[model samples]
Target chain A: MEQLVSALLIMIIGVLACAAYFYASNWLLDVLFPSKNKPADIVAKNIHITNTVRPWLFIGPALIALTFYLIYPVIESIRLSFLGRAGEEFVGFDNYAWLFSSDTFYQSFKNNMLWLIVVPTASTFFGLIIATMTDKIWWGNIAKSLIFMPMAISFIGASVIWKFIYDFRSGDDAQIGLLNAIVVFFGGEPQAWITVPFWNNLFLMIILIWIQTGFAMVILSAALRGIPSETIEAAVLDGANSIQIFFKIMVPQIWGTIAVVWTTITILVLKVFDIVLAMTNGQWGTQVLANEMFDWMFRGGGDFGRGAVVAIVIMVLVIPIMVWNIKDVNKEMEGR
Target chain B: MMAVSSSRSSLMWVVHITVFILVVMWTVPTAGLFISSIRDKDQLSVSGWWTALSVSEQRLVARSEHPDKQVFSSDGRYEIRGNILEHQDSSITKFGSSSLRPDEFDVGVVAQLKGGKTLQVLENGDYIYSSPEQWKGKRGKRIFYTANIPPRFTLDNYREVLTSEGLAKSFINSLAVTIPATIIPILMAAFAAYALAWMKFPGRALIIAAVVGLLVVPLQMSLIPLLKTYNLIGEFFGVGSKGYIGIWLAHTGFGLPLAIYLLRNYIAGLPGEIIESARVDGANDFEIFSKIILPLSFPALASFAIFQFLWVWNDLLIAMVFLGNNEEQLVLTGRLRELLGSRGGNWEILTASAFVTIIIPLCVFFGLQRYLVRGLLSGSVK
Candidate 1:
């Protein structure tokens, strides 16, 4: 209880301190360059100076934080990739060589490729189908919300939920888990789902796909709504079936939005570490780049060199999407 | 949508059925966890949650009364009588004296024992043992029965996890991390968003573009360098590297780009005349912001708050990296992961703990999901 109270106190103080800084700093800026009740020329000069300075005042703290946390880290990580474990000595390309030569790194890379191919495509496909079907139904909102509920659950929580489903009991213990129960009900042997080598990767991917389908659905549902009714109406009048109208007219129009949802889930799949970490911790041939990176970060009192190399690999994969996102935003901003 | 053909109506049935199956598929996992959390711990391991509603059959062993409790009947025969079931709600279906065939005799049947002793068991669990001579055994006879136990539910798992599993502490820690992390980013991002939107400053376009790029940078890229920076700062300041303040700042830094982007999109879409009129009325940027822009952008701010709150609350990687794993600082997700590692097979503990960690977000998601969806629609760059 005392700890809670102290935490509450700290929270209030922290927030209030940020508020105070913004207010006080802006107030100081106004005080330092007073434009009121001054000579007209001096007032104009003060207005110009404050116009330039006050925006900075509003933006200063955010800029400093973004630079320190994000921009500088990107550069420092790239530099550390070329350095030694403690990051004090330079080891040019040694970490990269080791990363390529290691069996575990190869396994992680292959698994990551599998995840990249499976998670996004499956999620996007299910999302599109569910979105289209649900829009035609009356209870669509309830279905959408239920599907979207998994998005709110943490990866660890979802792992636990799915783990309970995949739980195994040996030697005719009535098969408590739902999966094994069903398997035994159908006269099949119960297998340890997460321990299988190649197939277990698909099992793990199912959890992610289940969690992400809702996100894709929501976004794609919105995009489906954005489709012009006239086009669909025309398609229907042209003797087109529902499927034809959907694929031929509606989906093509929302291709951009579909791409957006696809890329978003793709980015998420790349950064997915918690599910694997909590579920298997890269065991059973289920390693991925992000989890492997996390492993190296703390494996032997912190191997900063190899960890940064893995991070750079993730960055390289993300660069195309990053470039595309910026260009899309720039194009949209210009239209605005 | 209104002009569907009659043939499509049959297809609509297919759609409804398919959607029903999909909804059940999505909802049953969570529903199972919720039901399991409230079930009797003994029944939970033996039956699936789908069967939680019906009576569960169990093989239970009970002991008959000892010979000291025997009474002399009117005919001078010794008899012992007692109820086997502790709870009257359960009914015994079959009984036996050995473990090999626990259901050797049907209820209400009399089974003859050695030495002219006969035992009769009833469905309601009442049993009678009769002997012609005086009963001499000190110990009671062991009787096994296949009993139909009623469905039972309790909140004991929740109580145990909350009180003893350290979830109660982690709940508070999650709040302490989430609330400030949620609020601080809103304040900082609202100001920055306002600047990027209304104020015509140099390089504003570049900054906006940069924010978009940063949106996709994998957090793995930042972990090592940030930890190094934290360690250095901690060395200089004589504090632990992993602390709440450090994590709060970290969440804020990560969340700011989205916050700014979402708010900027909304704020820029607001009627520009309001800010212009306020400016013409001799109001400064600060005045126009606090009184006008802030109130008008409440939906965006709220949506971002919900996002940041859920993100910080549900985050495990950040919590594991940025905060200590001790009871003082472990968030719910971290604690749940630890529990998953240690008590991997204990379903009651895992289910209860996982439900506790997810319950708040589920509530918030259900309550403010409209704003969340709206935020996502606008937050994603078209």
Candidate 2:
């Protein structure tokens, strides 16, 4: 309790310090410039100085934090990838060589590719289906909220929930897990679902798909609603069936939002760590890039070089999406 | 047209059925977790939560009172009589004397024992033992029975986990990390977002593009480097490398891009006239930001707050890297992962702890779902 109190106090102080910086620095800028009281030429010069300096003052703290936390780390990680385990001595391409030759890296890379292909496509497909179905129902909001509830659950929490579903019992013991119970009910052999080698990767991906489908649903639902009504009406008048209207008219219009949702879930699938860490921990052939990177960072003492190499793999995969996002934003800015 | 109308009606039925199935599919897993958390641990382990309301048969054992409590009846026979279940509300269905065949006899049957002894069991869990000579033993006979136990539910699992599993402390730790991490980023990002939005800056477009690019930079890229830097800073400051302050700062830095991006879009959309007139009224940029723009941008701030709050609260990777895994600093997710590793089979502990971990976010998700959905739409669709 005392610790909590002290932490809260520190938080308040930190927030207050941030507020004071913004306030005091802006005040200091005005005092230094004296834009209102100076002679005409001097006033113009001071105004220009304040305008140029004030924007920096507003952005300075954020810039410093971003550079320290993000930009510098990206550069440092590249450098660390070239160094040895302790990161003190340079090892050139040794880390990359080991990474390329290791079976685990290949396994992780393959699993990551599989996840990238399956999770986003599955989530977006389900999201579009649910969005279309729920739009016509009166209780649609309630259904959407229920489906979306998993979005709030942490990946680890979702893992626990799904683990319970995939639980297995050997012999004649009653199958307490829902999946095995259904399997037994259908007169089939109940298998330990997550320990099934190559197939277990799909089980892990299901957890992510379950959590992310709601995000896709919410975004795609909004996009579906934003579709102009006249096009659908015109399709109906032209003897286009409901499915035809959905495919030919509505889908093409919201293709942009669908791509957005797809990429968003794709990025998420790349960074998925907690689910694999909690559920399988890269065991049972469920290894992925993010969890593998984490494993190397602390597996035996620490391997900075190997960890950074794996991180760079994930970063390389994200560059395309990153470039695409920047282009999208640049286009938006130009429009503005 | 008439045939199309009929087909459409049938399609509506299909939609309703499909939606119903989907909703159940999505909700049952969480609902199962909740139900299992409240169920009796014994029943929860042996049976699915779907059978939580049904009578579950269990094999149980009881011993009669010690032979010292035996009495000589009027018929000149020694007997020991007792209720096996004591005060439980279960009925015995079968009884036996050995572990190999625990259901060897019917509830009302009499089984003859060696040396002129007899035993009889009843459905009400009452058993009788009689001997022609005397029952001379320190312990009574063991009676095994299959009882039909009705469904039971309790808060004992929750109580045990909250008090014994260190979750209560981790809950506080999570709040400590989350609340400030949520607030500080919003405060810093609001200023940066405003400058990028309303203020005429030379590099605004370039910075906006950078924020967008950084949004997708995998956190894996930052963990190793940041860990080294944090250790150095901690050495210089003479504090541990992992602490609440370090984690709060890390979360703030990580969450700033999205906060800035979301808030910039929203703040940039505010009417030019409002800010122009405010500026024309001699209101300084700080004054305008704190007074007019801040209050007006409440929705955007709220949207970002919920996002950051959920992100920081649910985060395990950042917490694991920045805060370390010491008990004093473990967040709920980390604690839960540990519980999963240690008590992999103890569903009672896992379910209850998971419920405790997820309940707060569930409440926030339901209560402020409007803002969350709006945030998602703006963050992605825009």
True contacts kept of 1: 0.79
* TM-scores computed on chain B for all candidates: 0.89, 0.96
TM-scores of all predicted structures: 0.94, 0.97
Please state the CAPRI-style docking class of candidate 2. medium
Give the TM-score between model 1's chain B and the true chain B: 0.89
Prediction 1 global C-alpha lDDT: 0.92
Across B1-382, the per-residue lDDT of candidate 1 in tens digits comes to 5546656788999999999999999888889898998998888888888888999999889888987999999977799999999889899999988889889999999998778888889999999888899878679888899999898889999999999998999999999999999999899999999999999899999999999999999999999999999999999999889988899999999998889889988999899998999999988899899999999999999999989988999999888889998989989999999999898888899999999999999999999999999888886636
The prediction achieving the highest DockQ against the true structure is 1
- List per-prediction Cα lDDT, in the order shown: 0.92, 0.92
Off by over 4 Å in 2: A30-47, B133-140
Residue A25: error of model 2 in Å? 3.0
lDDT digits (tens) for residues A1-336 of candidate 2: 786787678778877887789899999988988868669999889878887888888888888888888999999999999999999999999999999999999999999999999999999999999999999999999999999999999988999999999999998889999999999999999999999998999999899989989999999999999999999999988989888999999999999999999999999999989999998899999999999999999988999999999999999999999999999889988997
With a 3 Å backbone cut-off (N, CA, C), the pairs that clash in candidate 2 are: none
